[model samples]
Target: MTASLSYAHGTSATPLLGETIGDNLRRTVEAHGDREALVVRSQGYRATWRELWQATTDVARGLIASGVKRGDRVGVWSPNRHEWVVLQYAAARAGAILVNINPAYRTTELDYALRKCGVGVLFLARGFRQANYVAMLAEVRPNLPDLRLALTFEDDWAALLDAGRGVDEAVLAERERSLQFDDPVNIQYTSGTTGFPKGATLSHHNILNNGYFTGEALGYGPDDRVCIPVPFYHCFGMVLGNLACTTHGATMVIPGEAFDPIAVLETVQAERCTSLYGVPTMFIAELDHPRFAEFDVSSLRTGIMAGSPCPVEIMRRVISQMHMREVTIVYGMTETSPGSTQSARTDSIERRVSTVGRVEPHVEVKVVDPATGAVVPRGTSGELCTRGYSVMLGYWDDEAATKAAIDAAGWMHTGDLATMDAESYVNIVGRIKDTIIRGGENISPREVEEFLHTHPAVSEAQVIGVPSEKYGEEVMAWIRVRAGATVTPEELTSFCAGKIATYKIPRHWKLVDEFPMTVTGKVQKYRMRELSTAELGLGKAAQIKMA
Candidate 1:
């Protein structure tokens, strides 16, 4: 397992780092002054370069008036709205660390993030889907002693806007001041799988550089109109959607609420959107929508799918039905500013469908043997490692954990198991920690999950290893059947028998109505393990069962 290096097909001398996202946005606004900058169609809100700058400044001034200072943490808990983008730029201009809070977070989750970040101010929506954000904040206010202001999108916005009056001139002057590119710009908490969330400290250079490289990889330009259905709280939206659009002076069309397949199609058609970015689930929903064929989606030129493995069928439909010219699959964790490798647009269809594409420009990726810490050769599966300008500064207030994930040589060890092909395309096999060993044979849970997804009755599936007496572990699966469909353990076992090895087939199955998921929509397999062990009453034996 010796590590080797392979450079990207094209290389350039351009620096991969930048001063600040705000600086880059200001330059774009100056160059494309009258151009449309952002469109929040649901709210009937649109901002050109000039109007966006003014609004950003107003928010910055309001922040200052509310006692925010450089390096202070400002938390935003809202859906994908125009104000969310305004808050991002305003915090950058004010030198405050923007902390994105998932709108779906419960009271306990919100309290934990707010206290962990020591957030001084919070911006929230009044209510969405029965979660009254303002009420939740009020409930947690007593516990969060550092919080000084609670501004709402519905109630307190006007007052906050009025507060921006006297400080307008000062805000403009402050925006002109030089900012350190390496300074921490935001803290994005990882979607915790095993334990509590950990904040990944991303610097201005980390995020801005990632945006630049992503935009260049997609060949984005001033006239490009990108549709963003992903939530703004995630790194995919912040870097790939917002920062990339700003860097290229591209128009960003945002849908402010939960994703609806019909709405997404309409937005693309009406806006003439050239690009779209979403998770695999989003694409699946769009493709499965009954009226999918009714819309004219020929305007869609390119798209980026990530967060989970996408089905090959979905990719095919994107090209054939939606007339997509390029569909790239991106892979990375929050610690890498969420952009490590992407499938190139020019790659062959087989390569694009089989892998997660090549490493982006100025980024280094390596596959290392998990047990020995040695780099694995090409075409071998190992833990993926990445090093680049986009690597996070560290976990906020968690030195030991940060040191464990990021090495002294600057490579961030992603806990994903993957193999690099001869052409440098990385194919994700499974998570290093999620791999199941059954009867002395290794099984990839992702492989089983993908196979299960192809089943007509299955809507979603999760596999985990549980304890066994004869074998070290046995395969166990929990599946969510599609509406009006029925599936049994024996039938699924029969289906997998010839398609995969007998040992990889699940010996036990649980048909679940819904899966416990994290805020970001990731299935919580660790929780499933606990539930299965408790219900089976097999004690330690149940813990070793593999799925």
Candidate 2:
């Protein structure tokens, strides 16, 4: 029998939606006029589809009145709130490119995004937690000649909307009519692990259809209420959570401004939310909260656990304890509208936990030899690549980087190493660039990390390659022990004895309160390497090579 190659494409009878975001929102409102559309617990806001349309249109008009034009960039820097949602649709309706500014960014990062994108108008919250956005903007304003205006959600938000009263609806309608489905509508910065961040530019068609299909994969409907605790700046929240809910006419429930375990549990119980969204760590926090049993989460039937590969044990616990029998694992990056594959509601627990499912609707995914770009045979590990309508137009204003990422055939070369089963399920092994070469043997840190997760005292684990004089590279683990649990490195290494290969076992260990991560919850392994090398005085070892 011929072995299956690592290539799969998704097909469905349902045609892709060609309309723009505004057009889709109008159709949804027409169908579910009186149905609940949005519920913001932090702001005590609730709106039906009709009311949401009105508010969205008002904000769209507000953008036009503020002199935003087609192709102009408008930046939104805030946490998850009603205003952020309003601005997202508003920018789409006004034909402006919505630039998502990470709320956690300081002056340097914020300044770079604003100037790079040439943002004409900026919408921001006064402050989020400890970062005072207003002060940071003030510090960076002088260098941003392209920033025509700045509007704060605290005081200027109302006035900005009121400014629309003077603008006619016809003007907004004309702008919306001019928008093509392929027109760029959003720009999101990828996590700059190695260098400065690059903006991933997405179109109306790129995101809207992806969102619709994501909801379809989850079996979402008008009756489903989705609790979204993830940050809107990431595609997981905006495209998957908000856009998914809106495209399906489902109600969007915001637990809080930021992720709060207590708030998530309370909101889920109070709203009887049918679905929930979070990364694996977020779910872990909710499951391990001291008051975990206080709230009833019986309504949760499905959701997504992604951003990183979820431990199999945690997946089982979430399914059994959280009542999320249909919860799936999604896999992708910001460049691919953030999801190339997702498990189905009917998939077996093993399939859902072990793989990221098959290719998503209208998307083609393949694992190829990293150097040769040839499709790999089943069970052979290679770099995963995806091509589809969902792929971003390119990195914003950086054609060189864009060309380097998306090849001539239009496949986005994801630097993730993965394997495909004969059944077509893809298992992400680790990052191709993250593979550790110890004593000339290849080791996947994810493999060791997953094994560490099985340890009773280990709550979280991040394994990285540290420089070694003799071996050239050695495995080091950073662990977060379970609260009230005592563990030492000696105990952990002893547990690994006779269980796994000697080289795969971590040679050094450090206990950490938390792993260094991006705002979107992705671990920074490069940072870990730098810190570990410096702390361990491995400078000379880093320069050595295996003889």
Candidate 3:
């Protein structure tokens, strides 16, 4: 472990799971059948591990009876509902690739995701927030030739389970036995810088092992009660939240469909949750809540805080006030089953807040020179690359992207600049890519810029991330209008109102004739970010030091 070369690998004797997700669930149910497995406090629902398996079996058989063949894609577009968890396992049990759609997606985004994966059966909520999912689905259903049926949670939930009553138990057993651990089971749509999202296809081996190791790092057990408020659509929730709990036979507790600080506090106090999960912003909201002190969260021992930098002050408060003495920070992209490096429960406050901890078990991480693609010396900032079992199979149907990201030698070059310390602790400095992560949501600047170009008056558009106190970063758009065409900020806002997610909408708009360019005539996004920060009087926010 000298500081000469930047490379490390986790070696463990514990064997990785070699069975399908359904088999893993069966093993856990056999051991912890009567134990409380899931609790949706918001919906007033609770179920044991055995009950959950029965429900999951019903849905799996129903999917099979509905002409859902193995290897087909089943999409679920909703928030943190109890059924979302069931669908996670049911799809795996039925041999369908479960595609996780962002709940905040509007018509344009949803249409693209549903068509991209050729989702056969879509399960969705009727309405959430401002978007009427039913109406949006109707608008796009005609275009989706592969979409066979769309079922609503409230209307078709019972019917779906009942449809499985006639399915023979031997049918499901045969399907389960025919599956392998290497089969693709989940498709998570992650925003790319190329104006569209890419579906990262993951196998049972990739996600199941990552979840087990992450939970093992935190020492999760059957007695642990985890309160997860993160959305079920992302790896943070689907892999780390639910899979982590199920792998260890822990209880999965949902606070609300969407993030509500009060709901989280109340759920923790009422459920006596032992662990919690969220990004740093979420922890900040809970810690700063007016009635935060009134809740009894003494049951908490450990949890995960990730997706953004963990500030020193915020981490300290979370450890002290939230009773999470062992709160850890994880680092990885959606391509790595969502976790590659994680801090241990015994890490010091300095290491926990400053670094993303050491590499996880059965994975390898290294710092490499981006230009040369050669491993760099430790303590030197370079692009972080990971290679191991947790890497995704590839981007769905995009061979070029798959090759571009994961190299010929099997290394996923994470386009993130980082440095590995002498102790193998990693610290992320900046990203080489153009994706903007605001409030734990990855927003592609190209996607938003393309949407803005749809406006008739918009001649050209550029998007960048600016500093913010709350969300760590906020989206700002610079528009160059077409000649003889009139456009106002109000008009632009009105045009993008229901087309994109609220977070993707620009928080700051500037009408400009030309952008800052390099001598080679390329747009200098770094210069734009600097100028916007100065003009918007956000310099103070930008200077808020990080760990």
Candidate 4:
């Protein structure tokens, strides 16, 4: 009757794990003591389970010696590096809340995060790309009186480690004993479309179990070496990449301080990596690299392509050329420790390419009508919501925002519009806010963007609704053309002629060098919309709609 609005719960005999991040790390180290735990190619760093444990404990002791007590907020602002990994585990071991600061953040955003979370200690690289951390810290340090210490990855960080040697081992051990599974241990700021970012406070149990299950889905083990090019600041890296590896005793390989296509390819070939992780764009860069064929990626058996929907062609190429037959698509936000649904290694290629697979083990997912909050029927588009242990405790220190996000019934309302099949595989349509209403017809930008990606000359496409006079809103696309290839708007729209619905096709097109992206590689559509509207003189269109 009524097709019974979509809802699915993961069924499994494997019960949820009940241990803190520190405890789980110790367990995994004992199980795979001789196995490689970390490898940072840029820094030429390598560590086995024993060595990594000792190094992590040293950092933990250093933090304690520096006056970091349990539950203190410690901010880490750096690109992917060996020190970042050490601090991640060290903070958890020392019973401190690790606040991930985006390496892309400037002084203003950095100051807001530090003050919002009351961060007492900050760990940052001396310099990343062109942004000088020292300068930014100098700008904000005056306002951040709570910040007692600032350690750069340069010489200052060396002194921090040395400070640990003087502290008695019992202090570190006592801090470890005080940690609980449910105590908040991590704070990741959700990159909001408007206003300041809200910190998603997560506990050890939230991320640890999510990571273990994600790794299990990818068939990870002690022998699997995972090459991670994603930033450690995002849940995609810290939880999905690092936590997944540590829980399963797999090796975490860092290609560079930041994602480098050549570095990723070279690392995969040199290390004979078994697993890899990236967003779709990262994969595209690696696949399109001039020297792509030179690398030996045959060792790759599985990996993850997420952060956004994977285009069909890209997914096919990754499977055929990259040898990632078991590449999975994960879907979730930082609020849920990153993954609520994932494609499995056993999933068919069709299933892997089309859906985000079934609900993750021990999680419940449902699609509901946005207007009424009632569950929507199968194959019907609606807001996707999740409920499980993986959900964060709440946005840190923001009760009003937390209440608005999580309902009284405990569902974390993911603003994504989605549909479910009879088999329970979920298909993300687009964000609810990304919907475009043109002449009273609703259009999903994701649907049109996917269609445009099929064009041979289009390297990447991002669609957003810009203002219009004839219609309430019109579809506009910013496209990145293939290198040395050219395309005109007329020719491209003509290519879409019969394949897609007329209204869904983008009306205005702009060829661009690159799309504005977050540190985690998510395209900022709102910024694109703003820029397009101004350049196209659509100010009148905005007033027309609002009025």
Candidate 5:
């Protein structure tokens, strides 16, 4: 839908749809000057709104001085540091599109993303662990034809700030003159599993409005301190972790490096963090840590969990042991500003645990049969389609792919298979491309996979839930053994005995050498399915004698 189209679903009380993100930030800064805006715990840095406004202005001036113009692309390739937040605001202030490049990217991956986005300036960390970002940039320099400036976080930050001296008024006026609410603010690339990554162009309004809605949904306020361990490169970090807190005048605690459960605990205790945002794997790791019981995490109130389905046991621990007010399960992709459906705090435990919850305010969702392109009846599985203000402005320079995803009615057809229950809560069953049709019964691999993960010995599991000639498709399990542990195929089968149906049980099991993964670490089930089908001939059928 066009930016002027107001009503999407629950967006009735939202502010004017046409306002720009920078304008909103400017207003927030003006209103909450003395309030602390960000807390960089690693650097021992805290900035009030007034200080953050000035720093953002200074960095915007520095970017302009470095030849970054309006509509140009600037890449921020760093971990969860103050600079990452500064660069985002600075780029927004200058009307430059910020390209989020994951800090975990290596030379090859970085080259691909930088070249694809045609980035003009890169703000990078000098070095972290084995990643020498400066050295990697030097390697990519030859191929990055549009790249003009390399600003390192360590040695060049002071010099860049110095260059902005005596230019605040000029830069602020320029920012006001050039900024527009509809301008593209960020180009977030999706982790491509099937093909090359697509850069989803998010408008200034798209992200800002989403942040505001998220804050409202979670009941955030000025007194709340949010712990943000998710990387800023991801939408979870940018929209929910950073912008959500900033919009509400809340304090954000950034740890600056990879997540350590102990470090996270310490930060939460030290900062008195009241909320947290993380993926399922992150929480699983934190709960599984040996010293988890020693930490006092009583301060946390609420948070959002995504990336995968959270188990019921883990949810219990989060509420019983950690004492979090609520753990909301959110589902979306890079295309929809990364939030479409969210579990409300008041939802029943069955709804919260079994479904991903209802569509967010101002978002319209439908389940349509992929082949027929017709809306399905409630509770019938189909491709989940979404249309909303947060829907992205198409993939960068990939019109064909964009057209394939978004239709003429503005509905973006998410590749996920799902169903809406009587309460309108959406339950994601599986990826449309990953469905397993065994014996004419369409099976969701996620269901079987989640059930199998409950097994104690199974640290990680993937169910290619692939095609069989006799049954049409068969369930195959590829498992990763826990360290210094062993489980045979029969034992794993027995583990699923009472938990899942007989057909859902994997007919064949293989201990994988290593899982093929995407850049963001999601297991590539398509590849695993291919390997399974190739290794175990699916065409053959076994004759069984019925008792």
Candidate 6:
């Protein structure tokens, strides 16, 4: 018989959960009511499961009184905060779809996202780093007709809770009872390296089950304390960090508002955290800290290193030095409720260090030819696709795009290049698409290209990801300037400073007459990356392996 096609399945004796986010929270609270549920050192706040449940219900009732209705889009634009966590469960409890807006977003990106989703109420932090959320929202809120209210965390959190006291508790209970497992509860804006971002509409069943399964892979329990330094805006924080801990009755420890190596080290030691979460760069930063030896991280036994692949060298050090012998790696996108595969704690060291591990429970994975759509044999590279309850309902309000991404058969095409061994171990080889993952943040080239085109000095612009040792990949732009338009790279930088995200701005710039193209005139981004890598003396950086 011919070798079987590349396909795999994840079996589970436990069935998928059929409960809403609120339902799951109530169940966990009933079981671990006295357990520590949340900790935010920046806010100097901590809460038990019962306290968290009370806070979430209060916020949910407040949202209802503030004119938020079921199916409404509620946006939260802030860094990792205790309010952000409360809003997450509260919005779900009130039957509102929570929209996670990136904290790094500027006026243009912010306005586009809020308007695109028709967000009714926005909760925001005033400022972080150089970006001013208060001013940016002020500049854009008038244009956002759907945005009836914008509440600042510094001034409004307490008032929102007080407003809930006026509403009847029965009303909040009714709203929670109306929510179902399949109801769309969260809209995560995913830029997948193309154009403006798309809101990946995920249901309660999609993320809750994913979080539960991920925690199970780590062998979590109520005693496990998870240190999460990743930002809450992404699935890495909300799903894998918070949701994962909540599902298993574990404590969620926030290192700080933003990721600081010292804060992570300090939090782990002080909190006696058993688990930690971050991208590979974060692990590198923590390990390479000048005072690394001073902190005792012996409490850590398990965690996850995701966003990008983890190098073997880094994995070795993490297991030995960080005392994370059960460290795991997860593989998925925002559309798959953010996790379709994860490494198990029992995986062999070689497999744990090298692969993305096996398919997730209640999920299926297959590698197939990009053109033929036929399953490829084992050890053959092909596009990776997943199918299961974890897939999103679809991209919010983008039916055509959704159809293109998820096939009629329900397989979510990942557009990622991968290979499977006979043992069904999945190894991510590369991407079929172009995306610049700078220090774990996914940057879209088209979004930056469109913004640069608005510049009068620029006739055309193209962006590519160049190899970087620091960020794994940094953005590079090649521009065809309009004739007689004398614009320097510094001028372009200044123009983009307050308009777009700082990381999305091109780190390398080149003035080009024209781009290399194929016979059909498709601009070849690979050629641009190659030429830019050679010209910028980045060969040494390119040679440094991250996986």
How does model 3 fare in lDDT?
Answer: 0.87
lDDT of 5 by residue, 519-546 (tens): 3345677677667766776643333211
Clashes of each: 14, 0, 0, 0, 5, 0
Point out the higher-scoring one by lDDT: 5 or 6. Answer: 6
At residue 447, what lDDT does model 6 achieve? Answer: 64
Model 2 off-target regions past 4 Å? 1-3, 540-547
- For model 1, how many clashes? 14
User: Can you write out model 4's per-residue Cα lDDT over 27-87, one digit (the tens) per residue?
Assistant: 9989999889999999999999999999999899899999999999999999999999999
Model 5 spans with C-alpha error above 4 angstroms:
1-8, 16-18, 166-168, 456-460, 465-473, 478-487, 510-521, 527-547
Model 4 ranges off by over 4 Å: 1-3, 540-547
- What's the residue-level lDDT of 283 in candidate 2? 89
Candidate 6 lDDT over residue span 366-457, tens digit each: 99998889999999878899999999999989999999999989999998888888888898866665756788887757568768877978
Q: Per-residue lDDT tens digits of candidate 1, residues 1-547?
A: 2335332332457766557777887898899989999999899999998899989888888888888888899999988889999999989988899998987888898999999989999999987788988788889889998888888888887788788786866565665484688888899888766567899999888888888878877888888999998888888898888998898899989865766678898999889999988876677668777788888888888878888777666677777777776878888888988889888778777787778988877788888888877777788788889988778999999999999999999889998889987778899988876788877799988788878888899867788877777777778999978667898888998899899878888888999886776545556777887788778765664333223
- TM-score, per-candidate, Cα-based: 0.93, 0.98, 0.82, 0.98, 0.91, 0.82
After TM-score superposition, the amount by which residue 410's alpha carbon in candidate 4 deviates from its true location, in angstroms, is: 0.5
Q: In candidate 5, what residue range of length 10 has the lowest lDDT sum? A: 1-10
What does candidate 3's lDDT look like per residue over 241-342, in tens digits? 899999999999999898789999999999999999987657866876779889999999999998766656678889998989988999998899989899
- With a 3 Å backbone cut-off (N, CA, C), the pairs that clash in candidate 2 are none
For each candidate, the alpha-carbon lDDT, in order, equals: 0.82, 0.92, 0.87, 0.92, 0.80, 0.87
Q: At residue 484, give the lDDT of candidate 2.
A: 83
* Predictions: Cα RMSD each: 2.6, 1.7, 11.5, 1.7, 4.7, 11.6
